[model samples]
Target: MFGLIGHSTSFEEARAKARSLGFDEFADGDLDMWCSAPPQLVEHVEVTSRTGKVIKGAYIDSVFVPEMLRRFKTAKRKVLKAMELVQRSGIDITALGGFTSIIFEDLNLLREERISAVQLDWQRFTTGNTHTAWVICQQVERNAPKLGIDLARAKVAVVGASGDIGSAVCRWLQRTGVGELLLVARRPQPLVALQESLGEGRILPLEEALPEADVVVWVASLPQSLTIDTDSLKRPCLMIDGGYPKNLDTKAAAAGIHVLKGGIVEFWQDIGWQMMELAEMAVPERQMFACFAEAMLLDFEDIHTNFSWGRNNINLAAMDLIGEASLRHGFKSLGLEPASSSSPALSIA
Candidate 1:
């Protein structure tokens, strides 16, 4: 069976969800109490593909909240414990969603094994980034024209261009004939390397690139202190917020500036799961994060392996493979109307 490892966006949301799930203890627990809680397997999912293939899966709540981010040791342990649970459950393949994936990649957790006598098997886990990049690219290609922006002539800027998803997005856009590619990130050396590898994109500061971009793909975390100047943004500009805590709408709201949720996909039919409800998706039954869907796609295809892992390892071929699988199994980029209409208050898997 496949699996998905996830967490709540905040402690309050986690408490509410815990109560809904009948975890009364968790419902009353404080952040510190939550940090010490064990991961929970909250859902057993059955999804049927358009091709009539059926797959079984489970959702493992890491019991992690964004508030734990400052507590590095707690954050690391939460992710590792969830991974350990997945491994012990005998799940064939699992996707690390949201910050779970980020922690795994950032901490280089692959070197870890034998979590309290359970040997961790790296092959059973996938970062699910390949499909996410593909979905984001598809969103850009499909949505830009609706706003009357021709991608071939539009300058696209990728925030967090040096990240795993961001770099993959940059690689894909390079082949799309965009007018120009602008790379933005916090660090310079990686940005320089990415620019050198692409041999095309202009590396620029986020402040400078925002005004010039016709389309902006954000895969980075927005600093809490940062405030976007909507007045400075181009009218009719498209912003694809692919980052966690997806709050760009609140920050960049303005006339003629369209913000679309990036890295999301819609299934043709209900997957008979309620996990998305916890994620607070507008259409919980059908809408889901592309990263989570990747695990489902892999399970449906019976490709029980880590299809996506490691940093900067995502290539055009991998994206194309997963993209094709995604469509064949009846998953596509969610439409602009639903994407724009729904504003999930918290970031989640």
Candidate 2:
């Protein structure tokens, strides 16, 4: 069986979800109560692939909210505890989703495996980044043509290009032979290293890259003070928002610009799980974050190991491996209908 470790987007949402799930104590209590709350295995899931292979899984809510980020120790404890619970459950493989994965990677939780005498088996968990990168890249490849943007002749900019998912997307785009690739990130050192590795990308500031991009792949969180000027973007620009809290549509709303939700995939058959509803997926029954699907894929193929982990470890070959499995299992990139005279700016597929 596979497992998914996840969390709510905010404190209020977390409280409301807890209440709905009959966790009245968690709902009635304050943020402090949440910090002390243990992870809960709230749902059981069964998915059948196109090849008729059925896999069973469970969803373990970390009971973590974004507010816990202010308390570093609390945040670390929440993630570690959830991981420990999954390991103790004897799950064949598991995926860390949302902030659970972020906290795991950011805090380097690998070294904190010994939690109260229980050792975390790293092989049983996956960060799920490989499938995410693959889904985002597939969105770019499949949707750009519908808008009349040929990737080989277009200038593409990847915000947060030095991150695990960002770097993997860059490698795939580079291999596909984009006309011009602009690599943007906060740190110069990593950005420089990425550019040197690619041997063919332009490392530029976000301000300079935005206006010139025909396609923008965002995998980083924008600063609270930052505001995008949608008017300055290219006439037929395509922006793929691959980050958390996916609010780019509100930030960059304008005519002739399309913002596609990235890192999302749609399954042909309903998986019959409520976890996606809590995640606010458009089609709760059929759609999910690509990261979660990675665990399902791993379980289906019997490739039980940490498929994706650590920083800068995602490569083109790994992306291809997962991408092929995704298609074979009847998973495809979430579709988007481009805007036209009669259609709205963007419509989900």
Model 1 per-residue lDDT tens digits across residues 213-302: 999999999888899888898878999999998888788878888888888888888667778988988778788899999999999888
Reference-based TM-score, model 2: 0.96
Clashes of each: 0, 0
lDDT scores in order: 0.89, 0.90
Q: How many backbone clashes does candidate 1 have?
A: 0
**Runs off by more than 4 Å, candidate 2:** 338-349
Q: State the displacement of the C-alpha of residue 299, model 2, in Å, after optimal TM-score superposition.
A: 0.3
* Alpha-carbon runs more than 4 Å astray in model 1: 339-349
Candidate 2, 49-114: lDDT as tens digits: 999999999999998999898788999999989888998888989999988888888888888969
Q: Please state every model's RMSD to the true fold in angstroms.
A: 2.9, 2.6
Q: Tell me how candidate 2 scores on lDDT.
A: 0.90
